[model samples]
Target: MKKILLFLLAISSPILSISQNSTTSQIDETFKAYTGWFVDAIFYEIPFSDTFQIPWVLIVLIGGAVFFTIYFKLINFTGFLTAIQVVRGKYEDIEKHGVDNLYGEDAIVEDILKANQEDELNVAGDQTPGGDNIETIRDESADGEVSHFQALTAALSATVGLGNIAGVAVALSIGGPGATFWMIVAGLLGMASKFAECTLGVKYRDVGADGTVYGGPMYYLTKGLKEKGAGGLGKVLAVLFAIFVVGGSFGGGNMFQANQAAAQFTKLFELTGENSGLYFGIVMAALVAVVIIGGIKRIASVTEKVVPFMAGIYVLAALVILFANFSLIDDAFGLIFEGAFSGLGIAGGLIGVMIQGIRRGAFSNEAGVGSAAIAHSAVRTKYPASEGIVALLEPFVDTVVICTMTALVIIITNFNGQFMEYGVEIKEGVELTAVAFDSVIPHFSIVLTIAVILFAFSTMISWSYYGMQGWKFLFGKGKITDLVYKVLFLLFVIVGASISLGAVIDFSDAMIFAMVVPNIIGVVMLSPIVKKELTKYMNAIKKKEIAIEEGAGDLNDQL
Candidate 1:
């Protein structure tokens, strides 16, 4: 704790001095210098042809998604229904059979040894001679800070932010309606990737003696790979993943969300002052601090409620617009498909459209970026596969459902004005979306603005937790350490709101995609383990070793 405090003090001095005196242009320029170098280094694009270039990180992301989808034998399909059941707690009875039952009388002694052993070595291996014995106790009582549903919501909160509201609009503005089709395809394929990584997240997680969960690609890459005799590679990848995700937490997850939210609010309210975003950010940071200080439990509590509410409102509004423009639905679909396949004079032709869609989809749902795995790692479950199953629904909700809705609304409302023009650029993603909503209903932009703020708020809080986890991995975990990170994270919220979006957006995107590099490597190397866990889980269900509550799978029962 003392070490953490001294470290915090050392860092805070410079931050405090800068915040008190730096001009906005100076701050922006400083941010640009740092963000530009990072993005330039990590996001170098690979040319596939004269006119097309794809980021190497994106290729890794897409490749991993496709590979996992096939390698897992389409678990995204076979396990989709089962995942729904898991989130509904249909299989929660397995929690009753914890590690205590594995050993009759020496459960207490074994648990003590388990704790110590896990601390010293990797706890991810369920069958390694001493490794399997160590996690028995942690796995006994559904070992996690949040329920399956809460975990899903927390992760969803992070992914379902501006990307859905603004990113789809941006894609459509540049690539036209064709981008929507590719985005949906990416989302579907990405489900398998989400399932694979999240499964590994739970499999390799370390449950602290007090029931705190520490896990993600960092845990899986290092520990799971060590078991496979690639300890050196695993450690390197883990560190790289940790570094990238921490940057993402600051950029994409924190700054981008705040910037967009503040942009929308300022436009909606006609706020002219430059510091409006700063004040808005301070309020958001305060609210976020209140929830995040309580840790994942509080974060889960807020997101479980906020996600459903905000999503419900946005979806409801979209539904209203769709219903109002019911006649144009078919026309929207026609444009989407036509623009997707037929060259619409888009920059790089059909390929450019496809690239825009997939890129934005990746940015929106974040299936393979591995950030969601951190949130899912905290789910309470005995079988790691259960959380992985539940995670499949994230992309479905964020992209397949919500993003599709947003796209349809944009396409339907703007069908007549050459809105589907391939070469034109829309500078404000939220504005395009807002215009679509306002077209259907007068004054709907106000509601949309509020929803944006809520979305940003939920995203900020969730990412704060995600960033802090990575921060803890880098700097040892303690109250002081945690406080330092949280302060720094909240500070970014204000900085994000106050700064120009150009450099920040580019950096945030590169950082987010950079996570894909190491994350995909770990997920690919560790996929066989995920497969084994899936098979065991299925067999347990079939043999009735895992109990199921009657009617628990019913959607009505969950509600």
Candidate 2:
């Protein structure tokens, strides 16, 4: 703790002592040469035509979402209602039974006999459990830290941020109204990817002796692949994923969030001069440090409250705007379809619009990115697929609902020619969103500003946990190592706040999108594993229900 404080003081001293201009300029230069080449390489785009170029990374993301959607037989659609039920704890007993009772006395006796047989075989130097049938026994007495609902919210807190507000605006500005249609389509498709990755997250997780859960793509890629006799490939992919995840934590999850929050806060206050962002960053960093130091359990507790409240406020505001312009809603839908299919004279034609929409939609919900899998892995459930089912709601809420709302408001606001022409460059994305809200509600800019900060805060804390998992994977998990990573993360928050968006946004975006490469590769390799887990869970539920019904029928017969 003392070293942590000293590190903070040392990094912050420059900000306090130097002029704001000097600080900003100095900080910007610090990461420029170091990160530029890496960012450019990862985000390199392949042009199909002059105006319809797509990033290779995005193709991986979109393709993964599409593959999972098809391979999973549109689980996103079929499981939508089931996902809500899971989050509502409707099937919690399924998890409890597996953990607590292990299917009651029959299962216990069977397990004991199996163990005795295995022991005898081992005594003869034969063997014990082998193949895919050997299950990792979980300690029902020591369950996970957070509930399914809490895990959902914790992951949601990270995703439902400026991406919904600012990213949607950017997509619209580039792709026109048509992008909205494709964006929704991509988000819906993304639900399958989320389900696949998260189910694997819980299936391949490691619970420490102290009951702490260690999971994410790192665990799944390594352990799941090793089981398939590809240990070397799995280790390589796991390391690559850890590297990208950590970079993403600093770039997209940390800096991008801080940068946007500072931009909104300073703009709202009409603060001028260099010191505005620097000071705001310091305060934001301090606040982030306080929460992250407590780790995921504490983070989950906070997000369960903040995610719902912030989402409700933002969604409620969007609802009001939509209701007010109820008559124009049909017209808005027309523009979205026409713009998507016809392109409405937009550059790159329909293809350009589709690319922009899909890109932004994927970016917004991050269904294929595999970050949410990390959060969902911590849920206290014996059935891994239950959390995966719950995860289907994330892209729906983040992209289909919240992002579409933002797009509608923007589209509606532009109907009067109050905003720039479609496909025109948007200078400030969030500010553009704020303008749409302000057109309806007086002084709503303040509300939007508050929402931005809260979004940034929640996202930072969640990302911190994600990055810490990666960090622990690379460096051995220890107290000093954790503290060091946390301190550096908080410092980067300040750096994010102080720097201009150009390099920071580019690097962060690249780092985040780069995560798709290794993550999807691993998920695709292990899709069969996730499918097996889902089948097992469904069968267990059926048997339990049948047994219950038979017991109830017997009771009625007796009565």
Candidate 3:
């Protein structure tokens, strides 16, 4: 504890000193290089300098999703019911049955026997349990630190944050309402991509002998691809992914969060003015820094509490706007369709709207960006495919459902002319959303402010995990190594808030899109293995392969 306090003091002192003094030209020059890249990528290049035309990366994202959706024969659709049952504990008896009333020593012997037998079958069947299988994690840490729900929540904590709130707003701003159509299409198709990547995430995970579990695209790209005879390429991709994941953690995951929060504050109370944003950013950075030091458990604990509360509150607010404008709901939707296919102008074509929808949707959910793979990698499942099934729901919840609600609110609120002229301009994304929400609930900006802060906080925590995983991959997995990377992350949050490095932000965006090139290669090459893993897990569930422990076993217990 003393060490942590000292560290915090060391970090915070620099911020206070810097703020108290006049700004340095050196700081400006340094800031220019970093933030400049970020802006260029997100704003100018995504649609290739146009009315939100599709980028190559997005095409790959959508194409890969569509291919896999068909290849899996719509596993996202057909397997939903089964996935629900599994998560709901319908297969609890499939693992351990007679152990509850067994003699103590005998139970241990029986468990050994069960493990030995399963190992033989697993090897013969070519089943790659990796680190995610329930047996894999449970046997390693019989009493794990997290519950299944907690693990799900931790994963949710990461997935369900900014991507839902501000990301959707950004998509609509650039891609327009037509993008909403493609966003849903991308979300549905993305189910297959999520399933595949997560399966690999579990398949390639590495657990320490101490029961510390590690998993993500880095492991899978390095290990899974190597096993499929792409050792050299895998190494290069793994390294590149590590670099980009670290970049992503800072930009899309953390600083953008602080930047947005700062904007919200400055906009609301005029509280921050210019200096207010920087100080506000420091507070956010500190909040993130404190929890991140505690690692996954701390992040999970906080997110489990924060995500549901924030989501429920935000969704309820959207509900009020929807019902309050009950009559306009239909008309609002009609406008969405009309704008979605506004083919009379701008290329006079169907292609324009199609491009807008797909680009906006893909950007919003991050389906093919491969970011979700980082979070899903840590799930407690023996079958790699199990997590894959769960992951498919991400895009559905994020873009399909949540983004739809935000759009509806914005469209419905426009009925009373709360916004300008009923069409969006380049500069009006946040304002558009703010006007819509404040229309119904006065002082609603307070709620929106809190929601944005929570969204930024949750996103930063989750992105920290993703970036750390990548850092460990490149710099060796050690505590000191992790700490070094984290300090840099915290520093970036403050820096992001203080400057206007739109270009650096753009560069980060490009890096995120660049990640798909290597990731998709690994997924496509090893798809057959994914299929095999899926089959073994399904068969085990079907056969009810229970561990008949001759000791204290509970078949009624959850998996």
Candidate 4:
């Protein structure tokens, strides 16, 4: 790890020199000149009529989500309680013992008995049960790395960042309060999309020789589609998804996060200097490097702690502002509902409002974008659908809960129309959100700044793992490949912080959303497989309940 860090610094020194020679503004202009066309091309909107244009990517994301919701019989709603139970370890015994063991399958039962017999011998005096013979016993839950809760947090860390804080502000500003209503609707529908892809992520995952799990759209698109006799198509989609993920991880995941965190931190502290960003970048990069170098287990461990803490702080702050303006709570919801359908002040009326809400919600939660599936695939579970069920909660938490909190705060604060004008796009979304927070609570922008930094830090570490997985898929997995990816990732953090490259960030954002194309296509194609896995997991849960009930009856009779 020391050598790797040294190598990263060594490689980044030249780029750092180049950035130093040119002013930050110069770099921004140069990057925009070079990448403007790419950004425009990727974000090209499809026109249904002269007055209405929608980005094709948003169409794919929302359409896929709606399809999944209906096809799964609204699993998002029906499976909500079950998802909580799974994360809480309600089905741990079934997951650990394998479904076959619950039905008293002779082969599995015999292995358990044999393992117990071997434990009785203890010839080598190994006190641990089964000792050297333990490998003979199959633990169904041992395949993956992290627990269901850890994977949820890791994925949540990636999605619940700047988008909830800044992006929601932008959406509500343009579409008025109506956008918030549609955003929640989009979030609820998106739950099914997350369930489908994550299930496939686990179903078609590749477990390495050393038991490291490699799973995501890349794996499932290739392996899942091949099972359905579309190997050629699957391989192409997988490669495309992998390339997009790596690019997205670098720009949107790593650099953009560092850049925003640095901006918010420096501005709040009144640190105005050419090198302030560079200095903050180094510190931020160093902190991120420590967490990411430990790989997924370390990443998961850090995120499970950071995500909850940061989210709790941000949510609590929002709650304070909400309760303070309790009188306006009804009015805020009234605006949201009225604006959603009436679209009185928004451009293009109801269509414009619906588009803004759905677009922001889809982008925020990233439900069908396929990135969350990469993180969810790492969960330790024998039943793929168990993790998939848990994954449905991500969009709910990110968009429905957190984003809603942000919107309500913005709406209630804007009752006097002092902060922003309706129907106008707000460029400085973070600042606008901060103003809303600071209005009711004195000096609350300081807390908002801290939350932004935490959001950026947690986001960077999780995305590092996502990008590395894609890197390994393209280049063979090895120590060198891992080192190279990490070095580049860390370097991007500095570059992102030191320079403001709007065009570059826009391109990366496009790459991130571009992922929706291949992912939605592949997941829809493999929906049947997800359904089968869901059925298999549900049956196991039912069987476990029946067994428990029968045992209780026998004990009652004896008593």
In order of appearance, the predictions have TM-scores of 0.87, 0.88, 0.81, 0.91
In the order shown, the candidates' Cα RMSDs to the true structure are 7.2, 7.8, 7.8, 4.8
lDDT of each: 0.82, 0.83, 0.68, 0.86
lDDT-sorted candidate list, best first: 4, 2, 1, 3
Candidate 1 lDDT over residue span 1-559, tens digit each: 6655675576455345545545756655655654568788777888899988887777888888899999999887898999898787766655334323332234343454455456445446454343323222343345777889999999999999788988899998888889999999899999999999999999999888767888888899989999999999999998888777777888888888888888888888899997898998898888888998888888998999999999999999999989888988999999999999974778889999999899888778998888989999988777888889999999999999999999999888877863445468877788778888888788998998999999999998888888888878878878878887888888888888876666657877787788888888888988889999888778656544322243223121221
Poorest lDDT segment (10 consecutive residues) of candidate 2:
130-139
Runs in model 4 deviating more than 4 A are 1-25, 103-141, 552-559
**Model 2 clashing-pair count:** 1
Give candidate 2 misplaced runs (Cα > 4 Å): 1-30, 99-142, 551-559
Between candidates 2 and 3, name the one with more favorable TM-score: 2
Off by more than 4 A, model 3: 1-52, 92-148, 173-176, 272-274, 342-349, 416-424, 545-554
Candidate 2 overall lDDT versus native: 0.83
Better of 1 and 4 by lDDT: 4
| Per-residue lDDT over 365-442 for candidate 3, one digit per residue giving the tens place of the 0 to 100 score | 676666777666666555667667777776777778877888788767765554544224345356567667888988
**TM accuracy, model 3:** 0.81
Q: What is the lDDT of residue 545 in candidate 1?
A: 33
For model 4, how does the per-residue alpha-carbon lDDT over 339-441 read when each residue is reduced to its tens digit? Answer: 9999997897999999999999999999998999999898877899999999999999999999999999999999989989889998989999999999988
Of 1 and 3, the candidate ahead on TM-score is 1
In model 3, the number of clashes is: 32
